[model samples]
Target chain A: MPDTAFADPDAGLSPAELAARHGLGFAGTRPTLGGYARQLWAYRHFIVAYSNARVSASFSLTRLGRLWQVLTPLTNAAVYYLIFGVVLATRHSTPNFIAYLCTGLFIFVFTQTVAQAGVASITGNMGLIRALHFPRACLPIAIALIELQNIGASMLVLTGIVLLTGEPLTWEWLLIFPALALQMIFNTGLGMFLARLGSKMTDLKQVIPFVMRTWMYGSGVFYASSLFAEHLPRWAAVIVEANPMLVYIELIRHAMLENVKLSSTLPHLWLLAVVWALVVFVGGYVYFWRGEQEYGRG
Target chain B: MGVAEVAERPAEAGQRIPTVIVDDVHVVYRVQGPGTPGSGSPVAALSRMLTGKRTPGLREVHAIKGVSFTAYRGEAIGLIGSNGSGKSTILRAIAGLLPIEKGGLYTAGQPSLLGVNAALMNDLSGERNVELGCLAMGMSKADAKKNSPSIIEFSGINERGDFASLPMRTYSSGMAARLRFAIAAAKKHDVLLIDEALATGDARFRKRSEARVRELRAEAGTVFLVSHNNQSIIDTCERAIWLESGEIRGDGPTADVIKEYQQYMNRK
Candidate 1:
């Protein structure tokens, strides 16, 4: 037997040391940030494909097919207009009420859908997480992409409504590109952050819709956010103006409407948009990456 | 041959590069259920509340006891165990799908787990799923697009009709399982852990998949197949590990370990 006990080569070393010596890495440990970014980059195509698949699959069973994508938000805008515009008579406070409402609704809906999807991304795709070896961030990233496409559809309807409401097309309207891009980044980050949280406490999934509704109410999606200064305390209005959803909505409103005025306290909407995108995206990504190995475990 | 000899024998035959090294790994699952103490009845809940006992329904299950093994390149190993014996749990641990509470699992490359019930996207078409699966496995867009047709063809889902166009939910379970195995097998993995995916396929598909597994081994990949079908194990794997109650009972040549497992089961 050649003295089996003495012959055992790795007997003296701890498992971690043994693995290190043999050039084996701890299988489920999170990769370094650069390495993780590279992995995410490599799977970029997967993100696109998965998001596309999800978008198509969502409406594949319906007779209207992808038209539901536009119809959903259109119907939602109509219902909100009926209640908030007709019933509450809030239209007198805002200029070009239809354009303003649609812009805010579309922008707020973008974040709302992204948040809801992000929260469910990990918990909803347990099978995919357990089956394949990939970056778990892909789920939320894909969710973000799906919502971007949804917003793209909604933007078309928003543009048509704005033009119908007699808002002129101008050079400033091109700012929508940067504004949308920043919002996408912010939404993606938030989704990723929520994906990790949702995977841990699936109960959060049930509570998310109510939270989103409350967020929408506070975001000035229907009523003018300027009214906050007139109604609420100065600190509260400033806090509400600083909300990420409000920042994004205000940015989109500025891009699409000529008459919409920038918030006086935070005249730099673009600056806030950029800062929110960078902070949330980086923070949410790290949070999600920290829980990389825990996503699929029971 | 002895257990040590079995692992070393392959080293002598080939390079014996270790692909997966699982060292004394432990996994515990904290599950909440109705049967757990102070969970079901209102009186129990009240008493537990009065006592301030946290997580009333939570029960800790030591799913994988301290288990250790090493898998080498170019080897096909079968894990034979009765239900609840931690076969799937160990596989998930190696695949990095589950967290380990103790010890360590080290691998040279990513370990992909092919479980029977892992439906990628039930509402997406099978063809779309193949593309997405390839992309998800880190294949580039062009490569995924290029290889998807062949993968779908390999699964034989389109043999009867253009079934690949239909949503995965429309396919039979066996068809879906076959498609999943085909997508997984299309990629060359350093360590592939399969959990009863083959048993869902027909006999002809099983034979084809077994042959594909050998080809994967020949490509210097380590494949661990967990199945109740001993004959498949005997045909596909040279080494087998017999597990019972979260611990390894026998580990050696397929025939020897399987014989021991059979003897133990029959005795019971």
Candidate 2:
């Protein structure tokens, strides 16, 4: 009877029920989509600062410092010009070949570098991930930002190349902003997707270079996408033309160069650019968001 | 089911609000070891995948087994345990860094985990890392910028040399730990879980950090200090939880629990 008198007031309640009664929520639960967006927004400063620090720290170690940002893409453009433009005779088919090759190289490198860095974002920052509590999306987003900054420097050089190549400055040149913005959105989304995949299957990092190389060859980075149409069959040509990288590169080329005719290869490329950006951004975001609780765990 | 009794309370239990509640929580780590049959070769892993079988060498380590404890607001609790014990695992689980396999952990706010090996950025200068760490902890850019100087001063990294301007990789381990603690403690946290971060500092720095821990507790935040140094625990915390082999062996006053832990260690 005395034991009955001392019995717990809520004997039927489970531990979870007790926790609920006290209004406690599970630790490390993934936030709702809106809530996740809010948290990510709050950490925007961190994303920028992290990316800035990475960019500075990376290039500062070399003798030329930040010049590498401009030099890396410029050198790649030169190499492609020698291979595809001079050796292969793609330049005869393309007008303003310098501007064309540089634009394609710069835009494609923005995405390619984003993909490479995104794959390493989560795995490479295990220290920060395990130590601090923030949105894991920050890593991929920061990778995109780092490349975006690099592309900014590359774009200045690109403008100079376009000017030196006798391409007249036209009102259409402002289209580069929108095109790069859309590409950034697309790259961020793709980076998030790859970050999630790379976190679990680290071997993806090794395979990404070959994939990007094949993609670059297909996207008309140094040659005309029209060649893909001539060489491959109809469906294959359409798929190759519809490639998001090709769409973005062609958009930039159209905006900067007056004489390069690409409307034949892919019409409504701006529409396709918007669509690719939206689809990849949303899909990658949701995919990365779902894995929020799994990123830092061993 | 029977209701488990809550953790031992202070004299002001009625006024205290619980910040962290670990209710019958379990954490298991699946680690790859050479002892497992399929752990060594990719071919074995491939065959296992083809056969729809689990990898043989993926050993399941039951890090924390049915542990339950409630930490109240403003209490600095020390986690004293032997090596391979579950002290760090429980801290990580409470911090939401590690996933719990069973049961649940409830915390009032985001629990920040600061371990000795928690490197923010090894290549960035200490000053830059301080700013970046503050931003990562949700401090606005202006606030982080405003607080960076005081945080650097508190870290004492600049006392000997201009280490704050040097990359973190150049700093000694102790200096790195000090800076990390300084950055974490700058902002008031609802729950701060520190793992062996205090053991690396000098006596004077330890005293200062212990005082800072006390100040944090005074500001209504729960602090969980995991250190092998029992003296620091007694110096910093009133209550301590002794973990042994992934289970709570004793949970009570720091002096008493540490004594119990010492005896068990000596006996073993």
Tens-place lDDT per residue, model 1, B129-159, is 9998888888888888889888988899998
Off by over 4 Å in 1: A1-18, A265-267, B1-15, B32-53
Complex DockQ per candidate: 0.55, 0.47
lDDT of 2 by residue, B49-129 (tens): 799986566578999998887777777899988899989889988989877899889987888888887767777899999
* Candidate 2 chain B lowest-lDDT run of ten: B1-10
C-alpha displacement of B6 in model 2, angstroms? 9.6
**Backbone clashes in model 1, listed as residue pairs:** none
Task: Report candidate 1's interface RMSD in Å.
Answer: 3.8
Tell me the tens digit of each residue's lDDT in model 2 across A107-137. Answer: 9999999999999899888777878889999
What lDDT score is found at residue A64 in candidate 2?
96
Model 2 residue runs over 4 Å out of place are A1-14, A263-267, B1-15, B32-59
